[model samples]
Target: MRLFYPRGSDHEVTRLVRSDAAAVATLHREDFARPWTTTEFDELLRQNTVFGFAARVIGQPKAPLAGFVLARLAADEAEVLTIAVARAARRLGLGRALMEALLRRLHALRAETLFLEVDETNDPAVHLYRRLGFVEVARRPGYYGGGSEGKSDALVMRLDLGKAPVSR
Candidate 1:
């Protein structure tokens, strides 16, 4: 999970498009040790069950995104692929906004549950998820690459949107 960069309500979240893939890739490059390529993002977007939203400062619709959330759906389940926020935007509530938007979208798609895996060390992310009503469902040992020659555990979290409130 990452912070969405724009300050205040200056940002707006909208459905991501194929043209936004490069910009999203740039974000991954800046935020992740191992970044995904534009082609990878394109492929993910091309999938029928995959969709995402991009956050950008209003009035600068053409500007690179401040953050984005990608997810994939299968039947009643949806998994958050990743979330990235620009370095400039951390500790703000943009991440929460994106996730609220994500949950709403998933609910519209009839997703019964949402799942995501976050690095155990991301306290902010874990806290956010918990506060959003996600619970620890499982743990994946060494799922993320980092620390001690690229090895870190991941906490699997789940939110039962069917029983939770989602903003429209």
Candidate 2:
């Protein structure tokens, strides 16, 4: 699936590869308080059940990744491991595109459901998941951090593939 943007965006989504670990790790660090290391990403990429997509700028052979989504599919279910878009690239639709790509792939594999956990304080992410037809199925209090103030709750969101609204 190819989604083209007008003049402002050269971003294109593609299947992620092991070599993308370093760039993905860098992007993860920009958002998450405890980001996964490059080695960890590489190891995840090596797993048979793990797959992902990366959004990168077109027109350049070596454009740095703008965003990425990692996921694991087991049997008939799938779960988002993590997703992040570079701070500079927010609001540009890369995150949605990556997720849509994943949904398409999961549909192809006959996946029954998709699950993801997001920090409740992340309004943008929570809104995006809701827009994509995911609903809050559960919550884990204090799942995000142990900061000075308090840890944030994590919303466990689920999307039933049969009802997923992303165009096939």
Candidate 3:
């Protein structure tokens, strides 16, 4: 699908293009403690069922890849595998924009529910998901490993896309 953002803006969100894999990988590595490699991204793109996105700033040749959202679709449900924004881009609303675009894409695919797991200690992400209408649905012990002190629990969140909430 073709995505367009107004020109001359400081930032813009665009669909993940074929050439974005490398940049995405770079951004992923910079943003996450553990990042997926370019080969992994290539496989993901070939799957034809995963949706990814990238946010860029205008006039930048390398488009630092402020953030990205990766999701998988099965039948009528979708799960967000990961979403991350570069450390410097965290407070710029890139994560929220990436997720909103991803959710809209999932809705078009007829997904009735969205599932994701967030680190229990990630308050900002938890708050963002809550504001996005995703509620705590379950918890998995030791879902994350190698935390500051040790392994940590992960909180599973879900959003029912079947219901049209007044807020976006």
Q: Of the candidates shown, which would achieve the greatest lDDT relative to the real structure? A: 2
For 51-136, candidate 3 gives per-residue lDDT tens digits of: 78777775574857777788889898889877888887777777777777887777777789999999898888998899889998
Clashes of 3: 0
lDDT for position 4 in model 1: 39
Candidate ranking under TM-score, highest first, comes to 2, 1, 3
Name the regions of candidate 2 deviating beyond 4 angstroms.
1-8
33-151 in candidate 2: lDDT tens per residue?
88899999999999999999998888663777889999999999999999998888888888888899899899999999999999999999999999999999999999987878689
Q: After superposition, how far is residue 64 of candidate 1 from its true place, in Å?
A: 1.8
Off-target runs (Cα >4 Å) in candidate 3 are: 1-9, 146-148, 164-168
Cα lDDT of candidate 2 equals 0.90
The window of 10 residues in a row where model 2 has the poorest summed lDDT is: 1-10
Model 1: weakest 10-residue lDDT segment is 1-10
TM-score of each: 0.89, 0.93, 0.86
Q: What's the CA error at residue 144 for candidate 2, in Å?
A: 1.7
For residue 14, model 1's alpha carbon misses the true position, in angstroms, by: 0.5
The whole-model lDDT of each prediction reads: 0.84, 0.90, 0.78
